[model samples]
Target: MFTLKTATSFEETIKKSLFICHATPITSAEEALAFFQTYHQADATHNCWAFKLTQSYRFNDDGEPGGTAGRPILQAIEGQELVNVAVLVIRYFGGIKLGTGGLVRAYGGTAAKCLHQAEKEKIIPTTLIRCTATFSEMAMVKSRLWQEGVQLISEDFTENGVCWILSIPDEQLDVLSAVYTNITRGRIFEKIET
Candidate 1:
């Protein structure tokens, strides 16, 4: 799965209706809701939205015809195999009405265009590693991990050294484990999980 590296937007007028779509990568449902609320156009005819998370998803027609607005937006997101994304399409009626089919096409097309133009990044699966190193080994071990793209989530100073909570990409787990073992001789390397 992939997600937008940065938020993006697209605007177009179709059949005299103005449609503005905002697409953003989100990490949580709360963030998605917040994005929708932040971009919702109170003065528009409708503010439809949809979001796809790793394990969950939701869409709102926002008073549009059932299955007309929101579902198409969600389909656009899924069709692109994107996760952790939220899309909001605001419509300002321009004194003309688009049929249900037109509405779906307009909203879905707008969202697709926005996402297509966005910069994307792959979602790397990661695992948490807990390791303890003596004071003397700490600097070297931490520097090597950083060089390998390991992210230090937290560090707790212990009596003898520092216990590190690291986020390591799954593809590099084996290599990192070997580095740790070789550096510390497997003395303080503790556990890796999740």
Candidate 2:
């Protein structure tokens, strides 16, 4: 999966109707709602939208025909294999009526264009792990984690040992766990956090 690196927008006129598409990366439904509320046009004819987050997704046609606006916008996002993204398409009617097909094309095309123009980055699946090691094993553990590209989130030193919080890519978890065990002689304890 991929996601936009920054907010982006595109505007075009179709059949004399103004269509403006705004796309933003969002990790949660609350952020998606906030983006819609902030960018929605009060006086425009419609404010259609769509968002995709992992296994969840939603779309709104606003006042346009049932599937004319929102679904197409969603298809555009999915077509690019984008996740954790929200797209809002605002329309200002210019008195020229566009058929349902036209509306779909306009909204979906605008959204596709906006996302295509924006910079994107790959989404790396990550897992959080908390572990404890004796002070004598700290240096080796930290070194192994760093060599495996594990992100050290926090470290707390206790009288008994050092507690570490790390973010490890899903693909590297097993390798890191093995390396940690080998380096510490199976003395360290680890817990995975969701």
What lDDT would candidate 2 get against the real structure? 0.90
Return the TM-score for each candidate structure. Answer: 0.84, 0.95
Top lDDT model: 2
In candidate 1, what are the lDDT values of residues 1-194, reduced to their tens digit?
Answer: 89888999999999888999999999999999999999988899999999999899999999999998999999999988899999999999988788899888998999899888889998887888788888998888887776556788998998999888888888888887888888898654455753
Model 1, position 17, has a per-residue lDDT of 88
TM-score between candidate 1 and the true structure: 0.84
Off by over 4 Å in 2: 187-191
Evaluate residue 174 in candidate 1 and report its C-alpha lDDT on the 0 to 100 scale. Answer: 84
**Residues 99-157 of candidate 2: C-alpha lDDT, one tens digit per residue:** 98888899999999999999999998988888888888888888778755578889899
How much is the lDDT of residue 189 in candidate 2?
A: 39
